[model samples]
Target: MIQASAGRDRIGRTARLGRLRVTKAGQALSEGVLVAVAVVAGVVVAVVAPAGIAVPAAHGAAAVSLLVRARTVAGRVGLRLTLSAISVAAGGLHYVLVDQMGAARHAAGVFPPVVRVLACVGIAACLGGAVAAMVMAATENGTTLIRLRRLLDGWLIAGSLFTVGWVLLLHRADRGGDGSASFLGLGRVVADILVFGLLVALRFCLPHAQRTATTVAVLALAALAAGDVLRILPSEPGAWDGIPLAAAGSLVGLFLVAVAPWLPGGVSVVGFNQRMMPVIGVVAAFVPVVFCALAIAAHTVAGGPIDTVMSALAGSVLLALGVRQGVIHADHLRITHESVVREDHYRTLVDRTSDVITIVSPDERVLYVSPAALWVYGYRPEDLVGARLPLYTHPDDRETLMQAVQILRQDAESDIRGPGRRVSCRVQGADGSWRHVESTINHHPDGLIFISRDVSERVAQQVQLEHLAFHDALTDLPNRALFADRVAHALRKRTTDEAPPVVLFMDLDGFKEVNDSAGHAAGDTVLRHAARRLRASVRAGDTVARLGGDEFAALLEWEAGAPPSSAKEVAERILTALTQPYPIGTMKAEVSASIGMAVAVPGITSDQLLHQADLAMYAAKAAGKGRIRLHHAEPPHAHRGTPNG
Candidate 1:
């Protein structure tokens, strides 16, 4: 019964996992279908109804489809789709009304005031919808929108100044003309500027991920701008060479807007072609210059003061635009120069530093090595560049270094910001000598930065200090502190079957006489000789220490099943060596040692063992110098110097 239940549980888990995969695939397919339908519809309309009423009708249908599809999307995306649908619908309505008005004007030679008012209303609604779309985009993506807006503002300000200059210059010439036509012309120019500016702004505001939609929208706007320019420049609007261009532009713009809702969302399209911005500014500045030059030419040939005055005003606008462009260019040059100077200054600082700095790629190859490498590691920068990090590391240390690299690489891959890691290892120099170095490694986007400093001198000094802390200065032997520490360590590791370790305490007999007769130097010589003798008498695993003036100690580890007599043999050997004479400089000295031996037992502390051994040494000194005494827990047995001697 349990096995059957387990099999069913396994099946359920597998089914759940499969369901998640299927859902992801289904969502992708749905989006692909929607995109394909939108693109096909746009292509069909563009090819078949380039300048027909069918264009706007097709757009209106697409807009309704978009509004219905928007219900399936959620959150900000749905809101964007809904706004885009409204914009497309308004554009479709404008196209339909304009086409109807054009037909009426063609049939009747003029449109009724009511029809004109309705046409105006449609244009106003279209403009309102475009403005609303821009506002929604800016609110949704604030940073990208603001940047694009700033760039557009610069171009607009320059163009507006030139336009104002021309208007002022041409005002006097238009005084004798029909005032209504002149007003209408001025209003048309202003409206064209506003519409063209909005389209350009929308082009930049669209995200880059919406490539298909953005491309189509840009083409639509460019066609519309070209059509507006044609209408404005030509003297006879109805008889212009490209009369169908304006209608075609309207068709394309409305159709693309209707298709926009079906396009993908959540793709960031914020990148602008920075390289083109300066070219755009230059072109904008040149427009006014060209116009002003034409005005000057006209004045020179025609010889009219009014024409010259108009030329002068136009020339003023061009002069302002050119000056603005020049100012912006000059600012850019200054900033570039300052940036270069700052970079050079920091480069010089890095070169002069004492520590070697290196940049290593993610694959562990060295990308860059600072000039300080020559001084620190006896290697030129070129010698280390492109080399793997483990090449110069000690063979024993390479494994540890690689492990650290793996950890840091994992952290980077996981998007975790870890603290800088520090490692100390041996780095081989050019002269075949290894120098200890301490390196601090920090992670960067392109690679890791290693700031390594030579620490050989520091490491040597640390070793010296540590030795001094635990050893005798004159004899260079472990002191009482270290000796006691070893005893404690052995006690902690002791087991029931193991024989306890032994402690031997020895004191030089009559050592003060050598110091008084031959000076303190001879006394130091005697102590050094005794230390060497004590070390030689013990096993290699034993510890020997100098316990201050005329005093020394030894610790011996006894293996399991070793007899107790072994301790006595070591004590007797130490006594014989210490009793022999020591040569000090030009003089010879003599000293005998009183030795005491104590064996460690369970539940006995290091201090207690040392005290017992000390007591035995005192007893040996009293019983007569140059004797070995074994310590016991009872007073009578503790005084035994040598058994049966």
Candidate 2:
């Protein structure tokens, strides 16, 4: 009930804060009082009719409910006054019209058929309008207004146009019709028609919220009205047919931009879920459906009805349905595309599994190697993918590795090969370190699939195992087994096609004294140093292998121009390398050797050469501790010894 001056403009509201501005309790009392009044009026009329009152007692209760809703919804904004004014005026207007028409018009018993028909038409329009208001509220989704800087001042212009035009029409009317049919009456009718048409045209030309193409449609309607107005005599009222047409077109335009009940249920459902509700779907949907139904019913109630209203509604329904179907199709296509994309993503992940995987041609050439190549050989997956297996095999082992793959590739009849066939050999690494690998091969369609582990650590372990099998663990010079293996390898490399070289075997002299006095720690130091010196003295191609208990041996080949006494030169080199004093903790010790040399003849076997070498070495030891001897050619007795100078 707080009334304040909004502005001087009449459209701008003013509020009154006195007794006239009713409080809620006061308003509620008014409604209750009005309903009571209406009910009493109905009952009184039922018993003894009022000569003046005709609109029913029931309406009084309805007006109270309408006033309560309007006041509650429009609590502070001057909309409360607006709603109150609109609702009360509407209700009061109904009461006045009904009262003047006579109460008997409502009952079948009293009024003539034409009077009853007229009353029925009025009731239907009022009811239709009320129902339409409800739908309109929902479709607007409570969005009564958007914030605007200001309203246009075009209303004055429209009023002026209407006024000036009416005055002109009135003067004409006075000139044509009798002066008794004065300008006043003529001006009033002309003004009413002109006001409606001008407002329609003006609102159209300056479209605000052009919902349902209202502005354009209103202008079209104004044009039709203008045509009819021109046809009418100024003294008479203009025909009213343009009102319905113009209103229908305005509604149609409003329906297009305004959210209407004509849309699908799902549209409303999702619209409700958006963070901000753009449109209230359920409300929008109800508006148009109910609107069409009401219009159809109203038209049918109009004398025998017509196709015009039905056609407008049917066209709207068809357009809405078409738009709905298009949205559904778009959604379906998007889902299908997404599903295919997900499937492709899943497939790619499976193809690049972490396990060491390779595809090979039946011919044993590598077709593809998985990313696990880096894990096995320190090479990128791509480095080995198309490279031949022989490329990764050790130079000494490549011949055999290639042969194995060739066998698989050549065998067209077999599709399966060894699943657990292990080949132990050196594999090449990108860093030039030898990768000790154990490869297991499987025959595939195009080649053999070889999965290998860079068992370098394992190889070092295996070497350790072999060294433990043959040599002293503490010194790691050469295990006896490995010494034996190297001897055998050297012997195997020589044959009738290649002459065998000399084998020199030497055992350290006085190394036991260092161990017994300085401890095994010093003894180990002496042994390791001795091994290093022996390795340094030999040519890069020579084989130096250790025998247990500070015993060592060497192999040297005799080239075409080499000295016939090459063994003497090797003995000298060994002596010189060993003569250097070594530091073992607090003690320094000079170490020497009792060396034995035995030449394997052009076709002599390794067993014969080693036995002769041993006998010569024993002979040199018997001759003197620090000495060298040769045993070969003339059986076991052709022995010679030379003491270091």
Using TM-score, give the best candidate's number.
Answer: 1
The lDDT of model 1 is 0.65
Provide the overall lDDT of each model, using Cα atoms, as 2-decimal numbers: 0.65, 0.50
Q: Residue-wise lDDT of candidate 2 within 1-645, one digit each (tens)?
A: 112221231122122223333564575465446434433433344234332332233234334544443453432222322332343234334434433444343356444445434434544444344323322222222111110000011222223333334334433655633332233223323333333332332222221223222332233234323432442334333324333222222222222212111111201211011112123322333343444455455545765334443454355554544554454455457557867998788546534543456667654456887676776667787766666557667788876566555544433343223333456678767778787777776665555667666667766897777657776566556655566566667766765554457888888888888789888888888888888888888888777777777788877775555665766887889977876788987669877788888877654556667767877778778887678888747644344453233
C-alpha lDDT (0 to 100) for residue 578 of candidate 2: 79
Query: Per-residue alpha-carbon lDDT of model 1 for 1-645, expressed as tens digits?
Result: 634654564465456556856875886677556545654554555456644566567657757866776687766556655665665566556555554554454455445446555656655655565555544544454444244443444335334433444434245324523333333333323333444444444454444445445445445454544443433344433423533554444444555555544555332232333323444534543554565566556655766455553555555555555655565566567557868999999899899998998989999998899999999999999988889878689998886676666666765765555677787889999999999999888898777888899999999999999999999999999989999999899888988788788888999987999989988878888888888898898889999999899899999888889887888888888888888888887667778888888877667888888888887888788888799887876432233333321
With candidate 1 superimposed using the best TM-score fit, by how many Å does residue 64's alpha carbon deviate from the native? 35
In the predicted model 1, the residue pairs found to clash are 207-269, 208-269
Candidate 1 segments whose C-alpha is farther than 4 A from its true place: 1-153, 156-336, 414-418, 633-645
RMSD of each: 12.6, 28.3
lDDT of 2: 0.50
